[model samples]
Target: MSKDAPPHISGTPESSAKARARKLRMPPLRRRRLEFDDVNVVDKAMMKKAVGGTVVGNTMEWFDVGVYGYLAVTMGAVFLSDADKDAQLLFSLGVFAATFIARPLGGVVFGRLGDRIGRQKTLAITLIMMAASTFIIGLLPSYDTIGIWAPILLVLMKLLQGFSTGGEYAGATTFVSEYASDKRRGFLASILDLGSYMGFALGAAVVSVMQLLLSESDMVGWGWRIPFLIAGPLGAFAIYFRLKIEESPAFQATLDAQEASAKAGDETESLGTMGIFRAYWRPIVLAMVLVAAVNSVGYALTSYMPSYLTDSKGYDPVHGTLLTIPVLVVMALCIPLAGKLSDRIGRRPVLWIGAGSTIVLAVPAFMLIGQGPVATTLLGLLLLAVPVTFYVGNLAATLPSLFQTSSRYGAMGISYNVATAVFGGTAPLIMQGLIALTDNDMSPAYWLMFTSVAGAIAVIFMKESAQRPMPGSMPSVDTEAEAYELVAGQDENPNLDVDSLPFDTLGSQQGTQSDADPAPAGTADHR
Candidate 1:
């Protein structure tokens, strides 16, 4: 079959079905998916496959991301000078953040490309970009051989990686969630974070091994690039596997419908940045908030933790890795569980748990960890690790759901990039300064907690898509209220112990404080 040929996706609703034949010349999607006899609802099996693909793809991308940050300490000297080590490291991190800044642009570019061409194609190209750029970073000339251009080239490569990463997560999550059966989405979507943690674990292991193999001089001189070189083959390997996964059923259905209805007099708005901005700015803003919350915490732990421990807590770098291994492992294990629970309960409550706890725990955990002995630090980290998992695992599906698929890429890509660039990208730098300003007595945990508070507040108003009408099924009959309404009343559902979930998370305009409180433990939403 041709690469673009539709694979059999098991269960997509017949969103385009017409009541009778001889429909007036309608939009292409209305005619194709709606007119077809084979269309059906997306079920759990297809949802599982969608999630599987995303996990594999994200795993590859994140593996390299984690490896780079972990190894950068040993390798920092290759591209920088002794006189300016601290400044150079900061510049390197700046380069890292620079990549994040480009994500939104990539989102708009790749997202529109995906909407116009196909999600699978766009995704494949992005994976290629991420792997290829990371690999090339391994090959770049160092400061000793070249000069300023080396760092410039390094920044360029980072930009490429950032741009591609922008669309990868949102595209994969949306692709998976949109195809999932209604109740299955949160669980399956959480699989994305599982893949992320898998990458994190592997990256940690890879760098730890590299640290053992090479002396500091050799590692800084040449050995540092080898991991990046591995990414080239790794990217190719991931693409090979990704090729086997099915295209998003929703995207595929749209493609077929769009092609069928393209003959003449179609009213579908072409997905352009301007078009996306005009229609989806609000949801786009929400998606950005979602990415920033988890991403800020993510960078703090994965990227900043090594330094945080060594600089602030008086731990050795290699030992810090040993300490970090458990935290990363725990986070990996918990993310999927949180995601599955979200599927069973709902995204809103999962998000509430994640954001609320992070806000509350950030300060206390940091303060205690900073003051602790090795065991205490580990215990404090154990506590910190819990809430981070909740946020990362659940945001998998929640961020993408904020925008319509028609413009999801643009919305999520840009919003995530822009928000992270402003907040998450600078979180460590700013937090470090805040601690220094406070005479190094205060914990960044509190700063992280405070930093994440805005995001938690932002999430309070986030839209829940749990009961969103399945794609390929009827367009919402009550479009206006359906679009804004958070919940379909469950007063009649026998299983719903509504009182157990105190806040009006059912799309009610409840304040952030009430919306975020976890239900007494053992309830569906809280559990």
Candidate 2:
């Protein structure tokens, strides 16, 4: 009759024997006590280094992206001198999309490596590959010199950039998310994008300055390579910062746990590529849809807009590149604010604002850009930047929460890059091809609207992770006092679901005997 006792049965002898057999066969309900050692105390200095290193490398990665995007037209001319205007442009955009072709492979390889070796080591390798490839692009000979080899070489370099980049963002997000305290994760993770757009704005600024200072012929002749060449030094600076930082505490703890389990003769199943797909497919699919939506808008704003402005809106390349710089700078500055707001309100609400704004503003934003005045174009860009600020600022923090710490990086790499390859990287080509086919300048707007709708729907299914510990990790806090507070209050804390922690699941798998008996089945929360 006690609340904690097992259910009583009244039955015939045969039925009673069957019931007892069933009870004996059932697995025990696993549980553990919350303890101080389970809480991760945030080291402030290490947290700062982690954030700085990750953000700087992210900036460099996006800087390469910005350079390639802003220079698409010029590169087309340089690489395909015999092609007509439209052919040249199309070829260039196709090459940009081609970069993403290699990203999924990069994601798989580096994702697995990061999970196996360490996030820090894998990230360093990716940065080196990306920087080296970008620098190689600047040194490539023109189409006039290399005949067919020019475009071929260009495509190869872009693919390399894409390959390296596949690992960069996912690893960076995983790293920073693991380093941050639960309450400030949103704000801290948002700093990655602040660096991202700042890198973008810096690239735009560099290209614009080059365009302004040089004649059109001079730019096509050699000036365009300047931006790509800049990656060498920028990458070195980023790598320096990156190498100084240590691995994230959550990942380290997971590694340690795995080692200890191994030493005890408990073999945990490794979630390889197919295993990850099997175990976390729903979250993987959900993450893909969300990524598709966010990156569609993102690629539209960063990669396609410059070409659109130049080709359709009748702005010269100078003004087209120049117009986006201010908008990017303003957007970059506001990213952290949006991130902080997510921390205060919740991630879903902030994401909803992004998705809703995209749906509402896409048409008007395009219309303003279509008007062709300088002021109208800038206004339109700012309108588009609104949703982007909300979406990208929270994405790094949000996506990593979907999977457990054991497989977060691998799952993210697979989901994010696959979506980006399918939808994000190809946005410019798709938008441009749509317009060419239908002659609708608003085609890109409709695409943005569609993706945002999908994104909004995805948000509905997402678990709210704001101010909570990441899955498969302990409650992370900034101070020892906070750690004590968390441990004491954990039973009543809405965010701290101690029953659902990995220890229970892992312990159950070990079939390890324990002195304490399991809780009764009906009383346990399975997940």
Candidate 3:
């Protein structure tokens, strides 16, 4: 036999057919997975990884927000040069609001992707978009050089930044919450806001330093660009870490459940966006109202406060920015602690206390700041900051827990963004209008007081979400209406039997099994 001879083949037709059949019997290869594919979704090993990536990314996003708000005066002078100083500031703040206008659309689009694809992926995309737009703003020509193109381009960039931001916070909160144990969900989620305030503080600090060191002309000319440009490297660093993390285990578990359902011939209707709206509308409205309070108070304290101090209260702008630094630091520290408190006690009590205090103190706090010899002004801000942190810290955990997991991202995104756009985004503009109209330095205080009423309504109606099983993991979606009644200490029927109610009434009739029927043991980790 020759050494290079082919394998001996039977010449018969039967044998040839048999060989072809054998070839066909070989099994197909399995799809390859990435290295971290098998890692636990809530892996203890990845806790620090998840926290760091989320905080850094959130910090960068909010840092841009901080820069825009803090540098509004300088940005206005540069980009809206044709207007008087007052008009320029108004125009600049108007550009800032432009970002909020696009936020709801961003929320819906990004929320869909987050729900459909994965949380980590949506977050990464948002971070990249936000960072790029922010960096580009740094390179824009002043109105003096580019004429009408300056404000026009500024508005467009603000739109992009707003769009990207629409998805960022909701996605980050969803990612962090899914990885966290329900017992600690409040504390963990609060860190997202902690990073946010830190970024705002950092932006203010940077601008304040520049204001102190640079000439007024220099700050208006080019110094403002440095803060915007810093976003580039910061975003890159966040992206690198974000890419290394595993997908959220809760999301992956949902996928596993869906696939298993498909194989078992259980054809459940997937609720599209409209379906989500129909089923989750009540909770969505409540969440939106709650966010309105948060943003209004937050922006008033952080963004509009600087301008109010300088323009209305007669404090130097530089000194005002510096004075607000301690208030921010106090908020940062209190945020995590408040989160922990929510975890131990409950979310509603903490929220109610915060909202209630704001109603009482808004006018007094504003008056103190207006009449200040610097020390009293700082004290007044500190009083307001404490209440603000209570709401901000618990928001990440409470908002997402408002609805079922399947539609959580969408509901939170749309509701939160809409509230933010209308209230938080407009805070500075509204304050300006109020001050101009009333000729009162404390006009902003009255606005804050009015907004606090919404916060009170939200807390009174919102159900306690602490340590509850997440929505989809259970066999049924939670009814927010029912929860509200239960937590508000209202009994719909003391005499009604629990078993008398229809099984499907708990969750909407969209693709969910009866609550009475137990799900497969392996499908979810209820704890």
Candidate 4:
């Protein structure tokens, strides 16, 4: 298969027909078609429920976290002293960063555990953790009530939630994608992402409503805890749905294979973190780079902006939240569009466009933050959402495509969480620190630009995994020659190569550079 022509459609009619006829000779697992035209063999029935199940589970998890962000002002009182607003915010940001730190560790522990045991059990555990922590947070006493211990307790609780999320998303996304029919993977993945965003959106709407109903004094005093408490119910409800769901067929098949080995039930064979760490470190690094901007810009542009408007721009928090509704709406609208676009063209070009636009627009976005009219801010939101959609949509589908079936859950979880923690998780704090240090929003712009550049660098190095057959690890390459060789390696057809393919004949660059393969001393485009 060439890079340009869809791998799903690559083989000649005669070859495809002969191959279909020869299906009887293949193993049951191998007999299933992995391309768009094939039926979804894994979880054919339960897989029908995978996307909805993932969304419900993710919605519950993000709802818990999003409530804190939406109620930042209220939660600040519980964690920081009134003596210093910026200091309090900084402290709260640290608390926020603590969760990211925990996320990767959780991913490692959970990924290894899930691989050792099953995705079903790990997801069940994560949902329970999320629900318990959220409920515990609602019942927590504030600083005035318990002094320093109250804040310390809050930090500990955040660690639990962070750990749960680290495992949950990667597990859920991998499960859903692995089980889902390839034809609709992007669409289904995008729908799952809605839960992540909607959780925040719902939190925003809830806080917005509370602000309208409650006096500012009341909200600051005790009203803020209401939103955090709400997450408990949502989490508990989601757990019921999550538990009812079955295990993914792919993971089950792997388990069956591993069990067939002489070392059956030997946990180490199933659960070695070192094996994963040493083998697929590139994807982990690439994931961190890829999601940092995705998560950070998510924090800086949307989450941090509300507080920014209230404090620096002198806008009413209520008015600012209301005005920013369009950004969310635009994001929701664009997310699915971007996902569909990637399905048609490719994930790499979409990701490249996302990185490139972020490079060019990072400064302008912040500069426009306080500029001319409400209309200008609206324009900025449109610009931000559209390019950002490209990244988010691609990420929704692309990251999972990088891993092999054997370790997809664990690899996806750890890499995604660690990247998010450093870049996304710490974004608000780091950007705010720069602003405080420099006395300008411009500093945050530079901070955002730094992360965006990392994402672009990541995109430059990433091989196009879209339209490629799954159950295979992403091949090593940044250019056409390596891509050609990679295709030749996996191709069922013995005679296929770059020069003879329709895609190459069509003169498509196919997102692969024209450079030849590197020598032993040369650089490889790892994460």
Best by TM-score: 2
Positional deviation of residue 410's Cα in model 3 after best superposition, in angstroms:
1.1
Weakest 10 consecutive residues of candidate 1 by summed lDDT: 510-519
My TM-score estimates for the predictions, one after another, are 0.80, 0.91, 0.82, 0.80
User: Model 3: per-residue lDDT, tens digit, 261-340?
Assistant: 67888745555666666666777788888888888889988888887777677777688788888899889988999999
Q: Which one wins by TM-score: 2 or 4?
A: 2
Scored by CA lDDT, what does every candidate get? 0.66, 0.87, 0.77, 0.68
lDDT tens digits, residue span 33-122, model 1: 111122224444545555666678898999877776776455456666553656665665666667777877887788778767767778
> What is the TM-score (0 to 1) of candidate 4?
0.80
Per lDDT, the best of the predicted structures is 2
Q: Per-residue error at 393 for model 1, in Å?
A: 1.9
User: Which of 1 and 2 is the better model by lDDT?
Assistant: 2
Of 2 and 3, the candidate ranking higher by TM-score: 2
Task: Give candidates' CA RMSD values in order.
Answer: 13.4, 6.1, 14.3, 12.1
RMSD of 2: 6.1
Off by over 4 Å in 1: 1-39, 43-49, 441-443, 470-527
How many backbone collisions does model 2 have?
0
